[model samples]
Target chain A: MTVTASVSTVSSPECGAGRPDGEYILIPAFNEAGKIGEVIAGLSACGYTRVVVVDDGSRDDTAGRARRAGAVVLRHPINCGVGAATATGLAYLSNVGAVAAATFDADGQHDPRDLAAVFAPIYDDGADVVIGSRMLNPEGMPRVRRIAQRLASWSTFLLFGQWSTDSQSGLKAFSRRAIGTIQLKTNRYEVCSEIIAEIRRRKLVMREVPVRAIYTAYSLSKGQGFTVGLKTLARLFIDRILHW
Target chain B: MHPIQWIMLVFAAIAEIAVVAGFRRGKIAAKGIFFWTVLWLLVGLVAVWPDSTYIFARWAGITRGADLVLYLGFLAVFFLLFRHTLRMEKIERDLAALVRVLALRDAPEQTNQPRADGDK
Candidate 1:
């Protein structure tokens, strides 16, 4: 497939020459045709060009839109969960010899401006993984979401034995070592907590940066509901018992 | 024999016949046929002699044969469910790996190249 060109210019100073050469932004999307293009465009507008979108068997034109928005699109033939998509993206990045990689949500909840901040610790501070925490400055976050995020963080700490301000955050940067070392087995939303477990087991240096979340109605609707959260918790518990 | 014992015996006989038929038709492997045959034989034995379980129940310090059977049934169900879940998870992981490999193979040739728009 031919890669399209972004019309916007790189205006962010963070996207200038000092940016690492082999850094890539990985976006895991499932039926996100409406928002994937805009997310890619936003990243492109911020001058973050090395974007890879793993289309998780989207029935809509998600892959097409991402390709049109100037992203390297990787299409899964079947509908695997976000965890599988992220793992696929990481494998690709590792195979391509990427220096660093950051995962961005295709639902447009994450801000493109925060990409630099997320990657800062990886490059500047030598962190293996940098998580962009919305809880750090959750000024405008909805009450229910805030509570849910806190509960998820607590559960992740209890189950995986790692504490984070936002354990389920989609915005995370990984260094090359982290990318090659971390192997994901879980294929669902539970992968977020599994990543925390990996951080502890692999002894990877992890840091959290405060990042703003753009919580539109659509974005909010796309997030995990009560049933999904319960299922995620159950699967995480099963994974812990079986694997750990 | 009690009416319930008669019904269970008939059901076990029918199941055993089905298992034999499956084995004859080559639909079931030798190991699977052996397992099912043995399981059905045990079921028939229990159906024929419900009081036989009471001896084992007493040996295990259980009060009632029915209670022992119920407990064993629950254990069997749970064990099968756990095995099924593990098998399903392995299949999912295998499928995900296959999909990932296919996606990687089909990725764009210009994956690492700078976009033509000079954004990089």
Candidate 2:
């Protein structure tokens, strides 16, 4: 199967034949009281028919707001990591027989337009997994995210010998293979890095597509603290070195 | 060797085991594991001690083992909430950033609440 050239459109198949990759937009949110509504509406408008918001125990109104935005809501009742939330979302989609599942951030850095890029390869059966990369356009990407992406890329290089441009992009599309093989266990932001590590370890058919990224003051404020970066390092240690 | 003391010992043992089980089962996360493991050890220690709860209560200036029992059960709920609060804070921060990104892009707000910080 040939990889789709780009994520240019959000058009659906004329019919859902033999479970033709039912599209589910999975939003795993923690607090996200500010951005979830528009995310749900945007994906819905952008042609995502089923949107599932997993509220990872936000003390705020993340779940309530998500429900208001026409998404099916699942609350964690306490804070689990984004990894856990994403795992929950994947589990649900798999259980219900979703053919294709796209994970979009509740925090709003992703362009729904890029969904096609992330999923097109998987949608066309060319790759089992698709990752979005801001690294493709370095000048267009912001400085802080560039730093994070580099860290993600290099760590993945060290782990799997697979050099990914942006291993940590929140936007990813999965084929049934991804949903089944990549077992996600981390509950924090580090899970983004962990997913790529798993992909490299498993040697899954993976591709990175250039996608547009949006960075705003709010996202910057929420960007990982040094401790989060440290946590990512710690996970690398635990997973690769310590063998814990 | 009285029947009541033996009964109390069995009850305490069961309670301590339950606390350990909760930790093992991950009815709580890491914090849960650490807290309950320490607690279960303490309960087990007290259960095997020569002194009874009545004597400890009178001498130690505390109540019966009921307090200890209640503490173990309630700890799980509280810790779950603590982790939840921290998770909420982080998510709120991420959402705020994402919202600003979308808002700047001129996308519509999806929440019933106003555009500014909701629920702090």
Interface quality of candidate 2 as DockQ: 0.02
Regions more than 4 Å wrong, model 1: A1-18, B20-35, B60-62, B114-120
Worst 10 residues of 1 chain A by lDDT: A1-10
Model 2 CA deviation exceeding 4 Å by range = A1-21, B1-120
Number of colliding residue pairs in model 1? 0
Whole-structure CA lDDT of model 1:
0.85
- Clash pairs, model 1 backbone: none
True lDDT of residue A180, candidate 2: 73
Distance from true position, residue A74, model 2, in Å? 1.4
Best-matching candidate per lDDT: 1
Per-residue lDDT of candidate 2, residues A41-144 (tens digit): 67766666467787877999998898777776766656756777787777666666666778888888777777766777786656777777777755566676
Cα lDDT tens digits for candidate 1, B43-87: 888999988999989998999988998998899899889989998
Residue range A66-87, candidate 1, lDDT tens digits = 8888788899999989999999
RMSD, candidate 1, Å = 6.6
